[model samples]
Target: MVYREMETDAEMAMFVKCFWMSDSQNDEGIHTVLPDGYFDLIFYRIDNNLNRIFLTGTWTIPVDVPFTKNTSHFGIRFKLIASEYIFRESIERIIDTSTNLPLHYWNVSDETFENLETFSIEMGRIIERFIPDYTEIDRRKFSLMGCLYDNHGDISVAELSERVGWSSRQINRWFNNQFGLPLKTFANILKCHHAYRQIAQGRFIPESAYYDQAHFIKEIKRYTGYTPKELFELKNDRFLQLSTHDNG
Candidate 1:
């Protein structure tokens, strides 16, 4: 089980959220014990086939992204939206795949390996098949999601609609129905996420984490009640970092 985050090709960067690769061993997966509000795109790449597994789940309130825990069911994760979007709504409701139907995950309960494997196979097929409708960039929502991530969660619906060549109102409706939040709210989550990572990766000092160390503190406070020093994980972040036994 190896966890990594890499930069994507510039054109794909905004939506891609850094490609994630997971070679799950007999026992390895990830279950993020996130802060109160969070969302991420877990792009499953199996045997070189790439597809998206979008996860929108909220953290416990107080907005403390306490830690990331990679489970025994090994997998990879691509953090999404920085700090703007909340995952609670999406996890509570089911989002459809191509058909826009509700994705009732409960139908396939734990221990239902057969059904899970079948779905994974089909997902790989969709990525490899690359039919016209499933082209990577064609998924307008992902493109918009990436934009939100890249912009640190400050993009407007109009900008996303224009980029995707869709009507603003139409995109707004779809974005709301699909992601459970207007594009802007989700983007706010990403901004917070980006700031957190900056602090996490040591790129920014605790004193330098706030908006110019002064402005935007209120918004920052909304997500993380304290400054970067309070939330920053010293020693390795307990959750996302992992080592593999079978040479992962």
Candidate 2:
């Protein structure tokens, strides 16, 4: 597989995490997707054929994604706030799964995937135009997302509420309604995801994001269905994100 990723600029940073593309290179196999606390809008093709689009909701657990020969995927990984400010729809119903979108959803098409560089620019323009015109940005929710991602979800719910000036109940209520999970669970997924990068680099011991080794191991297994050791092996490229750690 050939995977490439591009982080968004400061202007779009609040909404988009990155734009990524992957080609299976004629190798057909299954890749395990571990939750990284972000949702994605993906455009892909198999056997170099028709362009297909899908929107994925926040994941609470691992999911197996199978790809066929000549498959290429292009996607925008979005921050939690995008659900309200960009997509403007509740993703609660699609949690742990994906929903198909129209072929030209957001005016994205097969031609957009012709060049990765152009794709990035075009998508950024789309987001730039849409968010400012159609959506009302919420400062509290935006700040909350920034804190969560910046801290790698290491902070407690109480602390987050205090910092963002939002009540714990309201924050979690928003999380469940928009992302289909509680704030703590999403935070744990983010924490575990950062730990996943460390584990991929052959570091297994618990870091600051975890309370201890036991807690670290439990969280890793909870989201990934693998212990740190297993993830380190990256057996058969099972953990897709780990495999792309270098590129990421």
Candidate 3:
């Protein structure tokens, strides 16, 4: 239930958004819903002279309407990145091309995410360097789909390769260059994300029947170090892990 808008003078044309909690029953995480990651970063344009970004993260349940609100912002998307160089190197890094430490963005603040919020002040100053006209990314490189997200956990590099018309090597390169990780890493991220989403939904049914009776058993086990019953009980921490800069 988080909605944000960038009307600031320096905000980009597109915005970044993250949906941690939602009523979506499709069981798709950010990568499946946005095909990029659990958290989405986008540009925003305004008043013919201003630009900003809508960076966000959110949560969803198992029965919410499909993209009924902001998280599904116009059904937009980004390319998939595995290691998530963004956390290591964010928008400022791209603009400054410097590997300096202490970077905070959107809401990701942690030694894990980016050294906590202590550097927010510095990040604000650095953000000013982003000009109004950076460049438009290729739209074709992304996708948005709320349906079929149920199958995201099973999707592999071979599947994505065919869809993107890329070889496995090329896909790996895309992950490292665009996201800063390898393809397998990204896939593992997605797997864990999907498992967490299902775990969150366990509130609806009997915990015992949920995992064992479902097909997500092994898949969930692979990503997360827990069984379905354990997942339901420990859903909070699992989701917290997902929320902590772990984009699908």
The most accurate candidate by TM-score is 2
Candidates ranked by lDDT: 2, 1, 3
lDDT of 2 by residue, 95-182 (tens): 9999999876887756677767878988998988767543456778888999999999999888888988999999999999998999
Give lDDT per model, in order. Answer: 0.41, 0.86, 0.36
- The local lDDT score (0 to 100) that residue 203 gets in candidate 3 is 35
Per-model clash counts, in order, read 32, 0, 42
Model 1 TM-score is 0.48
Q: What is the C-alpha RMSD of each candidate to the true structure, in Å?
A: 9.4, 1.8, 13.7
For model 2, the run of ten residues with the poorest summed lDDT: 129-138
Q: Against the true structure, candidate 1 has what lDDT?
A: 0.41
Worst 10 residues of 3 by lDDT: 74-83
Q: Give per-residue CA lDDT, model 1, range 89-115, as digits (tens).
A: 233242222112133422322332223
Model 2: clashing residue pairs?
Answer: none
TM-score of each: 0.48, 0.95, 0.40
lDDT, model 2, position 148: 94
